[model samples]
Target: MDTDRVRLCFYRLLQLFSTCAAFSLVASLGTGMGAVSHWSMFIWCFCFVITLITFIVQLGEYQPSLPFSGKSFLFTYACLATAFCLSASIMYAITYIQFLPHGPFRDQAAAAAAFSCIACVLYALEGAFLWLLFPETTFYFATIHGLFKLLETSVACIIFAFISNTSLHQHQPALVWCVAVYSICFTLGAVAMLLKLVKFESRLHTFFPHFLLGQTMLSVLLYASALVLWPLYQFNEEFGGQPQRSSDVSCSDELPSTLCIWDQKLTVAILTAINLLIHVADMAYWIHFIFIRSRASAITGL
Candidate 1:
């Protein structure tokens, strides 16, 4: 027990250090920020704050005082943190670090992105260690379906970040429908995750699995439509989109800062396809699980 406590404490401290270092590096960059920088900064600050609170809570062994299961809370937090940090690192690096002139600012930005990745890995490791340590502890999000839920939502979030204020869906009903599909599926997955975290899914018993399966099926259909419509509209010349990327000067500017609209469109399409695949896998798992469950029940009845 003492050894376990030491291990957890060391792990938490490492997470805290990485997050804090990332946030501080970003904060020290006093000027010339853009939308991506602001978003990355927000992620770093959020991670730092939450990690600090969690470290304190765990150190004090205050899990029993929380309204929800502490293990569930930690598991969920680690998963989300890993996703958020990875997204931040990727976005900040691609949008800022990759474009900045090789200098102190670029160095700092690169270091910050590196720290964010370190934090992401640490959080993922923490989640894995927790699972190995407490295999018996049940959290719906810890299941395969639940992990899919996390992936779907996380991917949707990155897609949203890429498209926000960019007007990638404007002036076309097809693109608008794609946006709607993303919103609906993201909401469904997010709400299901929230319910599980709050232990509300337990109240519904068998109904919860059906609910999950239904929503996953709905998401799969929605994403399939999005997968088809998004690329077709964005890449099809009939929709005023070029079949090939244009050589716009702004896209290749010396200080290419923000993501070009073309890049955003392509990214959204790719992420849409990826999320569609995840939802399909999620649907398949639930279907198989439900079928096996029913078969077992029928055998027991006989």
Candidate 2:
């Protein structure tokens, strides 16, 4: 095929993959824990709407000479891909706590986690081609897109760490303290970056690489290591034992202890397995990106 046709094929592939990812995300999140925060609902709803808009816009028959700017398409897909990946990671991590043991809930959550993994892969594809579609694009939107790419992985690491700490909050309040510190650092870093993005601060630009490399990478690995270590050894006992108050109070029967134990174990297993897949994908992404093209690394030095 000709060059324009090849590019159009990439566009079509992106829209198609993005659409599938969007619908899959909806299904996974809708039947999830069912107690998602309002902000979580809003973020997912926004992702669903935007991906649909992207699909529809790409498929439309009529357009001016330039239907949509390529930069606009890049920005839109970058945003959608980030949203899908971020939200799915959070859902996968958080839903593990809702398990009820021998019932079908753990099974459902596992299935949802699997679907979210699929969606994350698809959105990654969408992000990859956004760059392939325009190899020479640089600055602003390009940097924003790259930042979101990092955000997907870093944010997942943060979620994994935060929840791991939160899971043991009762026993290890000190660990929960780490969550507060990390969250503050992440928030402040994000705000500072946004200001730099707007004001185009040269001084911050010089230090941005250090933040992305040293600070952000270390923090991501910090939580990721904890997540790997925790479930590997301590998933079973993380919930601690039931209270003797149930017997002392009377008129109360605790959940079947065996089944409850099974619930926690299964949920931990599922979450850990999902996390392994994501880390594998991230490693593969790093390798593929570093070897396949130097331009991406030229952007972030990763």
- Taking the tens digit of each residue's C-alpha lDDT, what string does model 2 give over 27-97? 55444233232233344445556656654555563234443454545444564455555665565445442
How does candidate 1 score on lDDT?
0.84
Best by lDDT: 1
Worst 10 residues of 2 by lDDT: 256-265
Clashes of each: 0, 0
- Candidate 1 — which residues are off by over 4 angstroms? 1-3, 30-34, 59-62, 139-141, 247-249, 252-255
Lowest-sum lDDT 10-residue window in model 1? 246-255
| Candidate 2 total steric clashes | 0
Write candidate 1's Cα lDDT for 1-302 as tens digits: 48876887787898888888988998898866666677788888888899889988888888888888888888898899999999999988887787777899889988989999999999999888888888899866677877898888788878877766446778789888988898999889888888888888779988988998999999999899988888888788887665676644446655566676678788888898898899999999999999999999999999
Q: Would you list the clashing residue pairs of candidate 2? A: none
Best by TM-score: 1
Q: Please provide TM-scores, in order, for all candidate models, with all chains considered together.
A: 0.88, 0.43
